[model samples]
Target chain A: MPENEFEKKLKKMMDDFHLPPSTSVWENVSRRLHEKRRRKIPFFFLLAAGLITAGYFTYHVSEKYKQNSTAAISYTGKNADKAGNYLLKDSAKLSTQKPGIKKEEKASVSNTLPGTQQKIFKNELNNKLITVKNSTALKDNSSELENDNAGNNKQHLNGQIINENNNAIVSNNETLFKNSITIKQPVTPADAENTLLKDEVQDNNLALKKDSISGLANQPGNSLKKSTTKTPVTINKTSNWQWGVTGLYAKSNLIENLTNLNIPSAQYSNDPLTSGNYDTAFKTTHAFSPSAAYAFGTVVKKKIFKNGYLSSGLNFIHLSVKADIGKTVDSVIVIPSPAYTYFVRGYAQPGFVKTNTSKYNFIELPVLFQQNFFHSKKTSLSYNAGFSVRQLISSSSLIYNQINNIYFSKEELLRKTQFQVAAGLSFEMNTGKNNSFFIGPQFTYSLSNLIKNPGNSSFHFINYGLQAGFLLHKK
Target chain B: MDYKNLVRNCLKGNAEAQKYLYNHFAASMFGVCYRYTKSVTDAEDVLQEGFIKVFNNLHRYRHEGELQAWMRRIMVNTALTYLKQNKHYSSELSYEEINLHPVSSENPVITLQAKELADLIRQLPTGCQTIFNLHAVEGYTHVEIGEMLGIHEGTSRSQYARARSIMVGWIEKRNENIKQRRYAGK
Candidate 1:
């Protein structure tokens, strides 16, 4: 072909030239379309989780405040006279004892008493009944009091009944008056057992005294009427904030459609003398293989409502994908230039047995709301849902070109940031106080395209995997 | 599907219609991408991005011209944008730097496949390739190309001329190699 003819032919051939993109391109586009649709849907799950958590916390705190206020009111009213009588008896017992008891010893004695007795003791001490005593017998008596309480019916005694029990009154007076100065002695387990035995004996004596007091209260001469008011015991429940670290593993596959594109082809004849005509058409197809992804991160969670929590965390993720482009051309013809004379043998056919491997690293931030549906002392089951933002830290790809007989590697031009939605269920086992081990299955779907070029295949990743971690909590 | 119905369905966000449109024109559009980019992968990137723009902005089509022509224009603009953003092309090329020597053959001719010709074109400088593609293949005038590329019209013509001269020299050398190979074989 001459220069002018060649130019004209080239123009005509260029119009007919068609080269189909790799199949992964459509997959990329489809993935991006799905992401756009997902992003378009309002974050209703997150909003609902937030509203429910807020309502629960508000209701719970209000109920607790109401209970506390009611308890305060009852303590100050209706029980006032009974508390006054107990305070008078405590003052009388303290005055009868030695007058030199140390304040530190008094504090230790107060600390050792049971909850109800400690309140009565605090009231008596507040009424100016303090005495400084450096006596070993007083220490012994306080230890005896502790043992008596420890060995008793495992129930709290009422404040009003402390003065009414005759044997308890006698023990209190003896502990106060006895000033025997025993020298320092080594404490032994046998001595401790003996002390416990003595405590049991005192408890028996107290029971008898309680019987006597009941008899007296029934008598018409008794001025103090038996108090009928019963104080309810309240158990305090404290919620804690927890933090954890997790390692995760996932497997993902590319979702896309397969399509072929046409390329220029040449038909060869058997005769060496005749040149071949470029009438044939060639085509190629592309596909992706499954890939594995890994991630690790730390999370901090705060208890919001009863059995509910809000958590946020940062994660580092590594993702990889492999793609293959199949057979494209049948052969190439080399023609020497000057005379347009060339011997053509089948050579340099564009067979695209090529693989492209792409890897990405990202920093992800996630906010989630978790609710515990079932719980026990040792175990609980919960569900969580949230959204996350992922920023690409780095991305790279290695391309194997069979025709070129070389490996090409380069940094990929991917989107700097992406978004995802995540939801999961977890089973937590309380291993110790304020500590737990949790294992769960989680699912994450991309809400944005991974590549920068909108014209390129839109790549999105869907990951599902098991996440396990240990949580430490502070109340 | 016919182009009119396909366009209507695509406007309604019909996936099948979109796929049909893509399948129908992906190859020819890819050829245009290949002419502008450095590698097949880069070309595929341009093709995908171009189609996305086409799909997203389909409602803007007023049916004023051929659909292929409209899409081709988008692909060209997209390729140019990719080049500019990635800094793949230099800002300018001086006329003195270009090989302006003309080949001696009065009626020089060479036999080459379309793919081979495209490869030779890819070997040209980025500025020359953009100018040649816009002027010769895409049928854009120097004035239009200059407006699109933000350069002078004369600069576009000069770049195209330099590209043509380089290609002619390559063809002459290729022809000489063939003649020598034939003589050696004989």
Candidate 2:
């Protein structure tokens, strides 16, 4: 269709037109960009906090259950101690009786004493028997008892009781002397007899408790059955260290700096048709398309606190870029002796670019902080963030030189080592007692440029992909 | 300010440079978006989206042609995408075959102000308004418009003609009203 004058006038009027957008549009754009930047901060702290919390909570709950069980067993020990004290008191009274009555009581108590069993029987031979006899003997002679009470016996009473009950288990080896019994002298025959009597009483009390438990188990009621079963307890503890193998597939791209791209004008033949087509091609910016990148690695994680973990891994990462390079014509040119004119050899045409891919491989070591955000009996969700150190292992890529109008191979253009910031979220499902499988999205961005000195051109690789792996819990 | 320096500074994340670039092109780009969209709010939305793409893809622009032209292309594409994505515009954008009629080719002088002219274009049916703005104002050919809108070339031509005929009628009516008032004053 031919252009009408009215359409031309309208086009000119529209071309010169202008209307200002509202100020809030800029505000919204700025705010979104700012938010995107803020979101990019490493999530290392959150991951670490979560893992540490998880580890600590697991440890604390187990310890608490252990304490409750210990308290229950100690209840029986207390009852046995009370019975031993009663026997000691009776021996004190018997000291005043006739020698015959004392002998009969001693023989009867000796007969009732149970056979020596476990080493724990020594716990029943506490110093209370000796203390009681000494105190009772002293009461008969008031002057001597008062002096003993004011001296070492008072220290023994205050310190030894605490050591025997609680401190002995918790105190370190260095504090052994303080927590151990410090009996200064040997026991007399009378004192020995009293100790034997206390042991018999403790044995009898233990036997009575065992009989009561059996009696309760024999009952038909649910409550009695529960009481008998509750006496024995078991605990399952969580592991503080884990090791896993992970793999990821993601879209990868390099962000290039465009300002430094110095594209020279296309040099073409004098043919008008050929120059016109080539001019349009030369004016267009070269475009590189990204391909799917992959990474595989093994990670080692250590619980740093109740809910956080510190993790590090060695990964093999592959990144690639594909560029469409057009068909090329190779020709030998001869120059005359008088005029020195250089011609660009091996120059590929602009518009006919087919698929030419460049590949990059790196050995990367990632240091991350992982945290468990949610957990259940069989599943958990955690997030991780940190940094990575990558060493380029190999590079095979085609470099386009616009000034010379040629293609060349150059691996030296890129830096050998690169640093990247990374973050991820993982959902883990425990498949067995000591193993779990986890999968999540992982994002990694290079902090340093790939090109050594790109002048105004910079290239940085960005990767985001799903990572799936299995971990073995170390108990 | 030099545009090369401005673009470089913007790429380096300079806030002042970015604001300066946006302020320099916001009005003209908003005008392009306004022509493509139905209302000011929608035009602003398209303008916002277009500027974001411009900033993000600024590296691809190798200083070829005018920077305003580059930005304007992005704005137009963004507006087209917005229209297709929006349910209201997409439904109105359906291109059905219309009866062919011979309309007068006589060119009447458009006496309306630019703002009035834009408002008059907006008053046309959504299909006619879009086709008129694209064909008459943006200068897209029927074949190109057909490919862009996923319609046949003949359908695009018919739509463009219908829009042009209607726009001519509205402009003629406005001019006649102005002439009547002037004659009464005389």
Candidate 3:
């Protein structure tokens, strides 16, 4: 029986397929893709949350402020005068309750008269913004008005006759004068609260008003502050100037899409020297670039359609670059070199991983055209689209030159300059009163080269990268 | 850290427990990820995602087996996902065509320095190394390796054999290097 040698090799090749253990593997693709390239969440989510929180706290504070205002109103200027008048009116009414024998007779009775009569009180309060002070005053007045029922009794004693009422008032003038002194003592502010509470026969409305007044006086702030207040006020401050930091990373052979001409080696070394089938135009050259960026932009807004504004500005980006391409890419991870075996012949693939680090500097300018998707008095989210231009002023690259039939180092490869174009989406978030932090990925493609050698070669530099930034600007 | 206790506590949703679990398993899992990845950043990406799966599936652990084994399974699956997405390793080569096979030898590449062996192993084409690891060390049958690596069993066998041959050559060269060094030292 003859076994086909080719069949055996095929069977063996199939058998050699090494499947890794079926465990959790590269599920982080979503996260990295999100970090590298993805659309941003609409600003409304955060904006809504912030607004709701602020509104709630503001409402709570406003309620507290209103309560404090009521307390303060009870203790001041026109309010004090109203209190005095109320007490005086009540004093007169009480004095006139009984028909007088005569002025001389009433004067003698004054020595035995009770002090500080209760009075009916009512002050004109603005209907628009009523406070607890008004409620207390009105409530106390009602209760006190009930106590005035005694006056009805007086009317019963002597039918509602004018001359008799005048007589009663003249006779009780002595009692009125005696009550006046005691009323004045209570209004002195120190015992005003205690005095208001103790006056049982006094009108309850008057007592309540006194209570609110004293309560306002007891506030922690200048409780005794003689300074008067009318209403609360608001203030605003303005400033403009937004600044931020930048980061950058650019490499010539990130994809290991080896371009550029490698010089042919004439000798050999311990390490294997690799070369492509010679192309006449291809010569050894170097290319290396890496960068990260920090950007800033100014927001210039122009009012356009009814109730709308158009906002746009100049975007400035700074990138940091570093390079050591051929060497770094070579040293990253050593691949497993295949062993000579009976099952396979002719050039078993040797494993190799290039760890190249190439970087340099560049600044980009982008003029973005934006449409305001959503807007408010203070902030907005705009969908921006425009052309971005990058200029390579200073940079470097690593050249893998074949020396003695082995690859070796060559530096300062970005001895020339280049340019590129970028286009992409940006998500802007208003971070403060006039500033914002925007980040979105942009796709950038290189349009030209960084070096110029006087020769003819078709070696091309092509790349597409996802760019991200915090859009620092004043709105 | 007591890894077992960490796994147990992590199941309870303690943040500290989760972090410890990550630190203990991340390195080896990264080794698995590196074997599958084309870039360090890509490997790191795999490492992050694999840990997330480990943490997420921790509750389903049921103490059925070793926690590390469960985590390893997740990492392998993660690496396979990368394979499914990229298919970058073995599009050109077929394993079934391999003519040479590695027979049992007294001197194997495993005896070489771990770093050097790793270096040698990484040199095999993407699909070949995967085949070698799956069939020779991991002990999956060729058929199973075929299904996981997306190749015919014969292709798997060929890639694995080619990988072994390359490793043996590297091992031989490294041995020569050591001998040369010894002679030089003497």
Q: For each candidate in the order shown, give its overall lDDT on alpha carbons.
A: 0.56, 0.59, 0.40
- Compose the digit string of candidate 3's lDDT tens values, residues A1-475: 1023322332333223323322233323223323222112212333344345445544554454344423223234434432322232232333343232234323422322323334322222200010111211323332333233223222111133221111111111111121111111111222232223223323333222223334323432213222254221111111122344322222222212234333121221112222222322223323223444344544443322222323333444444332221111222222111211111101111112232333444444443344556554344455544444444444433332222112222222232223344444445566664356555555444444432221212122333333334434441
List candidate 2 stretches off by more than 4 Å: A42-475, B100-104
**For residues A1-475, could you state the per-residue lDDT of candidate 2 as single tens digits?**
3377888788887888888887878986675555445433323343354456645754675465344323111112222433222222332233332132245434432232212111011112222212122211222332332232222222232134222221111111111111111112122223434444534344322211222223323423211222221232222223357898989899876655324432232233233234324544344444346678999989887665445777777899998876555555443322112212222223343434456677889888787888888866578899999888777889876554443443434464466677788999999998886798999999988877775433323567778889999999883
Chain A of model 3 scored by TM-score: 0.29
Task: Give DockQ per model, in order.
Answer: 0.24, 0.24, 0.06
Residue B26 in model 2: shift from native, Å?
1.6
lDDT of 1 by residue, A124-201 (tens): 111111121223334445445444323221212232222212122222112112231111111122222222222222
State the weakest 10-residue window (summed lDDT) of model 2 chain A. A167-176
- Candidate 2 residue-wise lDDT, B83-123, digit = tens: 88765677787688687665449687977777777877877
Estimated TM-score for each candidate: 0.39, 0.41, 0.31
Ranking by lDDT: 2, 1, 3
- DockQ agreement of candidate 1 with the native complex: 0.24
Q: Model 1 reproduces what portion of true contacts?
A: 0.51
Question: Which CAPRI category fits model 1?
Answer: acceptable
Per-residue lDDT, model 2, residue B133, is 83
lDDT of 2 at A231: 33
User: How big is the positional error of residue A345 in model 1, measured in Å on the Cα after superposition?
Assistant: 30
Displacement of the residue A462 alpha carbon in candidate 1, Å: 20
